[model samples]
Target: MLKPQRPLKLLIIDDSPDFQLLIKTYLEDFGIVCLFATDVVQATSTAVREQPNLILLDIGLPGGGGLLLLERLRANLRTAKVPVIVITAQTTDGLESKARFQGAEEFLHKPVEKDVLIDTLRRVLSRPPTQQA
Candidate 1:
């Protein structure tokens, strides 16, 4: 008999260690396996290697930032359709619009409500390809 597969794998790219810890703790019980990257380079590498089902990206990353990473990921066929949720504090001056235009599935502001985050992830992951956000 085969073992049960996990529901989802999630990658979080953020510079704040405390925030990372908080998210990890908040999401672990929901059956999401969380992976962390403090910078764009590591995030990109992890995204390719881990092939997470979803990505929570922070806009203010070091070296390249989340938008740059989103561009790179969209250009790569292997990771292009993976649902990305932009979780950032910088939701100013069309930043959210830019993220949406860059192909992020959803843009979530920081200090994210736990229920909203989980619900958004669940909805995105549950949809079929044509319906995915």
Candidate 2:
């Protein structure tokens, strides 16, 4: 017999309320435990306090940006190993590489579909902790 899989905890760091709700609703059916933070402060606090299994971070934000948040997250010992999947509407040149270099485990453009989101989440989580970055 196999042990049941635990519900995956996810933190979504996006300033848009609509986007947050969309992601939560889309992922709820899969039994993932989703949390939200609308800005840099909230994101940072939540990342440390909640210690989510994965984070879906958006690039554009108020009071600093996702890159800054990512850097801070990486620096924090509490949440440093958490796998981060970068999400953004701003698909500027070299953004993906920049994110990866900053320790993002994966990158996904905004308006992501359910299947892609699920697949990416599983892929990131399945990787060993050392390989998450």
Candidate 3:
């Protein structure tokens, strides 16, 4: 008999309670354990402490913003290997590319549909982690 698998822990960094609730509902249905943080400070500490398997990040956060937190996460050894999917309402030029350049595995717009969000998460998490030199 095979051992039971542990649920994947997903950290969601977003400022909106509505968005958090929506995402939590979507992910929990699939047995993903959802953790949350509303701002850069909370996001940073939670991420380092929890060491989640993946992160769903929102760009426009209070405190220092999501990009800054992403950079810090990338720099930190504990959370550096975790995959990050950036979901944001901002449509400013080059934001997506910037997030990717800063180490986000995927970029998604706000109001992400359930199917799209699920597919993106699957794709990103399925890929092997990049080797650090």
Q: TM-score per candidate, in order? A: 0.91, 0.94, 0.94
User: What is the Å distance of residue 112 in model 2 from its true position?
Assistant: 0.7
List ranges where model 2 is wrong by over 4 Å: 1-4
Query: What's the CA RMSD of model 2 in angstroms?
Result: 2.3
Give the per-residue lDDT of model 2 (tens digit) for 8-80.
7889999999998998888877788889999999999999999998899999989899999999999999988
| lDDT measured at residue 66 in model 1 versus the true structure, 0 to 100 | 88
Which ranges of candidate 3 are over 4 A from the true structure?
1-4, 131-133
Each prediction's whole-model lDDT (CA): 0.85, 0.89, 0.88
TM-score of 2: 0.94
The C-alpha RMSD in Å for every predicted model, in order, reads 3.2, 2.3, 3.0
Q: In model 1, which residue pairs have backbone atoms overlapping below 3 Å? A: none
Q: What is the lDDT, from 0 to 100, of the residue 110 in candidate 1?
A: 87
Candidate 2 lDDT at 129 equals 77
Candidate 1 wrongly placed segments (more than 4 Å): 1-5
Q: Could you give candidate 1's per-residue lDDT for residues 1-133 as a string of tens digits?
A: 1112755788999999999998888787777788999998899889999988889999999988889999998888778888899999985799988998998989898899888887887677777986543
